[model samples]
Target: MSGDFYSERPLFGGAISSTFPLRFQDVSDIRQVPDHQEVFVDPARDESLIFELLDLKHDVGDNGSATWFLQDLATEQDAEGCTAISKGRQGREAQNLLTVYLANLRLKAVGTDVLIVAHEPILINPLSESATAVGAGLAVPAAQSGCMAMGEVFKLAVSSFKVNDWSLFGA
Candidate 1:
């Protein structure tokens, strides 16, 4: 594998702010599509939407909001969407929502991943190191891909803040 990940588009783009990752035994519930209007806004901007993890560790908290940044690729065929069904009773909303938006673009998670779970948004302080680090780190990938993979970029942002085995509903 190449040390430097090659991409025709940016990996930080095309990532949407999803409700949460639905747990399932199979991946059949996921599919690929082109219409991101339901999951994203603008669909052109490759900016990071700040999100706070709820009481749980990983993922956006129960009452959290994250920006869905994405870019639908035209080339390449391998595309993956989010889970169509929710397994637990906790997942009543965001059912069948596409979590991964892949199209001719591949993004790799590096060692820069970090998790910050709290009851409130800690990103409000612009001068804080956490905000700066997250902003700068995300900006690098955003700039690297030239904002090509908007969807992937948003996903990375989620991945960056998501904690291990952390549930949004605290289940």
Candidate 2:
């Protein structure tokens, strides 16, 4: 994480931008998917970034709350030890915050009912306040594992993800 550098890479019609090591390929064009807004891959780092949109009308076979939507997703992956984040005295969390995924999880939620989802495999080190999925449930050097150093980069991409065009999700 020391001495490494990063630059901005915008995606999804410039609605969001993220910092990568300036080496990862921005496959946003050639690797296009029907519902995916953006995709970036860094094979050297064995890492990937995927930004997807879920149209409530088209994607959900049944009308369910965002929590149920996310729960179904977790169940598909057989994700173990799934837990919701602690709530405040009001029994609610930050606006739109629905879930904190496993191993340095994400704050998943419905972005304007469009359900913009950002998925990443990263482990968070609470003491250091960084994230990445590598070395999760194990002790190892980050540099050797290659995931520890990507904590900041992952955070940047995720925190910046936004739905610039609300219409895309329908009015």
Candidate 3:
């Protein structure tokens, strides 16, 4: 962790940004990811950070939204032995907007640590046609060395996430 360097990296054409280790390379273009997602990965460590824009789930209340999404992710990825480690809201003003969750799961025989940051925008983006939620997911291989550093990276990324241009969400 002491040897690692972190800085703010732009996403979605600078409309959004987060602070993370420079070791994570932007792989969205190479991977042909969806338009709504920005993906970064550190291949050597088998770790990744992804930011996604999604249609708001009106049925899901704010209080436990992070946990709900974490479970949903576990299901989507077919992860086994999923265990919720923690969940909480962000800042006072962001209480209504941000919810985060951390979990541990086994994916494809690898134990992984996953952190999810879920944000519900105050306004829905017309261009996105109801894409009102901004979500970030960090996945780090639990068996790897520097797992603790990766955990710190995940926290920093989530905490520093910002939306520079609301229009990216069609605001």
Candidate 4:
């Protein structure tokens, strides 16, 4: 359909970074760096954030992609206590909190690529794991079709089974 064709174009293509908020900065004391320190000061990046990996959006635009907004759900103190507080009074509190954060990210990403990255374990508990297993946009494609669709037809095209009518759009 038109939706799939629009999603497969490359007029708005780009990749999303892993984490948005927790980026690396200059470390005054190099020795203070932990062995598992995820933050690394990259001179090339300057103030930009770094991520483990990114999801490639092939057809949105010329090399368009979306980086995920990652946050560390780990804590130095008692995780059980925090989890209890998150689920004790209100069962939906924790999910709601995360959803609000993601919604804010989505809003901030109105003009650019936005992705939310969180570990499976941290995002869901054992008993309630299946709830978030499918994820927010699992059934939907990762392409950003909003801006691309608004452009002229020259910027969007779709692949087809036959070559007789190259103007056709699909698959």
Candidate 5:
């Protein structure tokens, strides 16, 4: 962390921003990432961070939504032996309207460790026709030596995340 340079970087046309180490370079364009996602990568470490806007899953409960999403992601990727290493919720204010859920998963099939940080907005903006929640996922190779550092970076990014323009989500 001492050697890493952290900064707030704009995403989705500057509508949203998050702080993370500068070592991660934006690669959404080159990778042809979906419009709903902003992708960043640290090539040297083969680590990636992805921020996504998604339609809230009405069927899923808030208590363990992060773990649910993590497992869903694992299934989507056809990753086997997915195990949840940790899960928790953040934010205590009942009036904040947004609850953050975090889940760390180990995907044995892919040999990758994934940290899923999800924000579930209790009230969906009427202006937003589909988008309801925002989430950030960080992936690090299982054998990586600096996984903890990357995990810290992921936490910083999620905590510092801000919506400069709510209109980006049609608010």
Candidate 6:
């Protein structure tokens, strides 16, 4: 996917940073929210990345833990394959732990509280006729294929996430 020509446009000033393909469009205002920070779309692939900040203390149910929060979100999307990836502080703040998860969704919402959130999606296409018939590419293999390259690209994007400031919650 990412060759030598990719570029990253930082988001949220010096507070948080990550990279997305330069072709993506910043559509933050489309779903304007007081906390709905940013949204980027890769038009060619129908994929997207969205970032948000949420108030777990005030968000509906006392469903305060990341697990509960994701569960609540799952209600709206009916997504499958939800996997909790990480949970802990996003910075040095003690106000709330940042959470991360992965899911396959037709529609979905994910958040962190007192949380900083990001949603990155990769569109899945059916495997080639030969591979689909043989059921290969289901798990990663030594051979380099379009799917493998795409996975590496997304892995880099997810791994690139970092919190640069804690002021959103406290000092």
TM-score per candidate, chains pooled: 0.19, 0.46, 0.62, 0.16, 0.63, 0.47
Per-residue lDDT for 27-56 in model 2, tens only? Answer: 755655555446565544434455555433
Candidate 3 or 5, higher lDDT? 5
Count of clashes, each model = 23, 4, 0, 18, 0, 1
Which parts of model 1 are misplaced by more than 4 Å? 1-46, 55-145, 162-171
Residue 19, candidate 4: C-alpha displacement in angstroms: 15
Candidates' RMSD to native: 19.1, 11.6, 16.1, 18.6, 16.4, 12.6
lDDT of each: 0.26, 0.43, 0.53, 0.24, 0.55, 0.41
Candidate 5 overall Cα lDDT vs. reference? 0.55
Ranking by TM-score: 5, 3, 6, 2, 1, 4
Candidate 3 Cα errors over 4 Å, as ranges: 83-148
Model 1 misses residue 122 by how many Å? 28
lDDT of 4 by residue, 1-171 (tens): 233232221111122212222123324335353321223332212111111222233344432232122122213211343332132243443331121111112212123222322211124333332334433212221124322121122122111111232122121
lDDT of 3: 0.53
Kindly list the per-residue Cα lDDT of model 3 for residues 1-171, writing each as its tens digit: 565777899988998788987877888756688776777766554345777666665566656756777778755544343422111222122222112234321121222122333221222222221222222233223324443365577678877877687676555
Candidate 4: what lDDT? 0.24
lDDT of 1: 0.26
Off by over 4 Å in 5: 83-148
* Candidates sorted on lDDT, descending: 5, 3, 2, 6, 1, 4
Model 5: residue 32 alpha-carbon error in angstroms: 1.1
Q: What is the lDDT of residue 60 in candidate 4?
A: 42
TM-score of 6: 0.47
Overlapping backbone residue pairs in candidate 6 total: 1
Task: After superposing candidate 4 on the true structure, give the runs of residues whose Cα lies further than 4 Å from its correct spot.
Answer: 1-90, 93-110, 122-126, 129-171
User: Model 6: per-residue lDDT, tens digit, 1-171?
Assistant: 323234556667657676655655776645553443666654433334555555444444443355565666544433434422111122111111112333221111223443323332222223322223223223232123222233343454556766677564454
